[model samples]
Target: MTELVALVPAHDEQDGIVATLAGLYRQSLRPDRIVVVADNCADLTAEIAERCGAEVFVTSGNRDKKAGALNQAVPAVLDTLPDDALLLVQDADTVLNPGFVRCAVDALDEDEGVGAVGGIFFGEEGGGLLGLLQRMEYERYALEIHRKGNEAVVLTGTGTVFRARVLREVRAARRAGRIGGGDGYYSLASLTEDDEITKAVKTLGHRTVSPDGCWLVTEVMPTLPKLWHQRMRWQRGALENLRDYGLTRVTLPYFGQQIMLGLGAVALGLFAVFTVIVLVTVGWQGFSLFWTAITLIFVLERTLTVRGAGRRAVLLALPLVPELLYDVFRQLVFARSLVDLVLRRQEHWVAT
Candidate 1:
C-alpha cells in the first residue's frame, strides 16, 4: 500500500478549518498522515486541526505567510515519508470530494512522468451575487485548464498532489542551482510561491497533471470587497512572480487571454454607448446600424456565459450591466497589479 500525506498550511482560519479537515477525514482513499502547519494563528486553527485528527505543527517567526508555512512543513513531512508516498497540498478553506484522494493517487500511478495533480474546485455553499460572480470566474479558469489537455503549468493549491520522489528531486535540483528561485525556501523573495515552484517543476521536464475525476469543493470570497482584495492580491502576486522569474517571454498568452478578452468585450460595449450617444445627439437613423450590431454582440456574449453557468446563473443575466461592470473591475485590478510589479511593491498576506 502507498502512503500519502495531506499537508494543510493554515493561518487564522479558525472558522473553516474544522470543516475542511472533516472533509479530508471522509476521503475514500484515506491519507496515511495529515499534517497541518499552523503559522502564527491567533485563533483555534491548530486546535481544530488536531481535533480533526491532523498531526499539527505550529511555526513561530515573522515569516508567517503561506509559503513560509509550507517551507516549514514540507521538510518535516518529507523526513518520514516513504519512497513512493504522495504529498497533497491543500488550503485550509478548501473541502474535498470523497474520492479526491483516490483520484489523485490513481492519476499519479497511471502517469510515470506526472510530478503533480490537481482537481476542479466547486464553490462553498451559500453565496451572494458577488460570490456567484467569483464562482463563475473560477469555473471559467478551471474550464480553460481542462480544455488545455494533458500537461498544465501550475496546479491549483486548493487541492494538489505531488509524487514524493518527484518533489524530492525538485528540491535537490533547486539546491543545486539548476532552478533559479524557490528551490528549498517557500517564500523566495516573491509574493507567489506556488506559481514559481510549479514553473520550476516544469523546467525540470516533469509534467503537471489535471485529471477529470479529481474533485475538490472550495470557497469563494463571500462579499464584493473581499472579492476585490482576492483579485488584487492574485493579480499582483502573478505579475510579481513573472518579473522575479524573468519569464516575460511566456507572458504573451496571459496578456492575450486576459487583456484581449477584456479589451474586445469593453470595446464593443463602448461602441454601443457611443452609438447611443450619436443617436441621441443627432437622430436614431444616424447610428442605427452600429447600435444594432454592438447590442447583439453584447447580449450574445452575456447570454452565453450565463447559460453556460446553467439555469440559476441565467436568472442573474437580467442585469446585463453587471458583466460590463466586472470588466471595469478586471481592468483596475490588472492595472494596479502592473504598477505594483513595476514599483517593486511588497504585499502582506490578507484573508479574502
Candidate 2:
C-alpha cells in the first residue's frame, strides 16, 4: 500500500518547531512518517523535533541555503519511500488546517492529471497593524486567484503535497535540459525554490492545485524592514526564475503579469505627480460628479474584496489609505526588482 511521508525543512526555527509538529499530529489524515530535516540549525530544533517523534536529518556544511538543504534531504528521503508514496513538504512555521491532508489526498486521487496540491495560506495572528494588513492582502489575493478560477498559480512554500513519481519526473526533466534549476527535485540556483519547482512540474505536463479547505496559517513579517526584505526576495526571485525559463506556453501569462506590473508602476507614479501638479498649478476645481462616482466605485471594490478577512479587515479596507500605502510600497519593491534584473544586481535572500 502507498503511504504519505512528510519533510519539514527547518533552519533555526526553535520557536515554531513544536507547534508545526503538533499540527501534523492533529491532521485528520496524518502522515505515515514524519521527518524533520533540520538544516544548518544552531538551536534545539532537531532535539525538539526528535522529542516530537520525528526522525531528524541534520544538514552537513550546507551553504546553499534552503534549496540546498532540501536538495540533500529530498533524494535521501525519496530512496526510502515507495514509488507510489506521497511527499508532503511543509514549512517549519506553518500549521495546517486539520482537514488539509485529507482534502489534498482526495484532490490527487480524484484526478490523475493533478501532480501536486498546495495549501491556501493565511497570515498567523500578531504583528499588530502590519499583520492585519497582510491578512487583508492575503484575503484579496485569494479572492483574485479564485476569481480567475481556483487554479494554483504557485505551489506555495507554506505547504504542498506531491506524488513521488512526479518528483522523479521533475528531476529527469531537469537533467534532460527540459527545465532549469540543476539536476534535483528543487533547484539550488533559484531564490524561490517553490516557484521554480511549480514551473518545472507544469513544464513536464503535470498540473498543480490548491483546493478548498487545504488551508494553513503561516507567519507574517513583523516590521517594515522585515517585510521589505521578504517582499524583495519574493519579487526578485520570481522575475529571475521567469527570465531563466523565457516566454513559452506556461510562462506567457506570467510574463504578461510582469509587463503589467512595470506599466502599473510607471502609470501610478505619473498619475500621482500629474494630480499633484494639477492641484497646485491650478485651483481646486472641485470634485465632479463623474469622478466622484468612479472613485466611490473603486473604494467599494477594494472594501468588498477583503470582506472574507472579517469585520475589522472590512473596516480597515474602507478607509483604503493604509492598504493604499501598502500597495505603493509593494509597487516600489516590484519596480526595484525590475531594475535589479536589468542591472544584474548581486543576489540577496532574506529568510522569512
Cα-based lDDT for every prediction: 0.75, 0.89
Can you give the TM-score per candidate against the true fold? 0.87, 0.98
Clashing pairs in 1: none
User: lDDT score, residue 86, model 2?
Assistant: 96
lDDT of 2 by residue, 23-94 (tens): 999998999999999998989999999998999999889988888888899999898887778999999999
lDDT of 1 by residue, 176-248 (tens): 8776555664546555667766766666777887776776778877777787787777777777655555544
> Which candidate leads the pack in lDDT?
2
> What is the model-wide C-alpha lDDT for candidate 2?
0.89
Clashes of each: 0, 0
TM-score, candidate 1, is: 0.87
Q: Which residue pairs in candidate 2 have backbone atoms (N, alpha carbon, C) closer than 3 angstroms, thus clashing?
A: none
Candidate 1: Cα lDDT at 92: 87
The best candidate in terms of TM-score: 2
Please identify model 2 stretches exceeding 4 Å from their true place: none
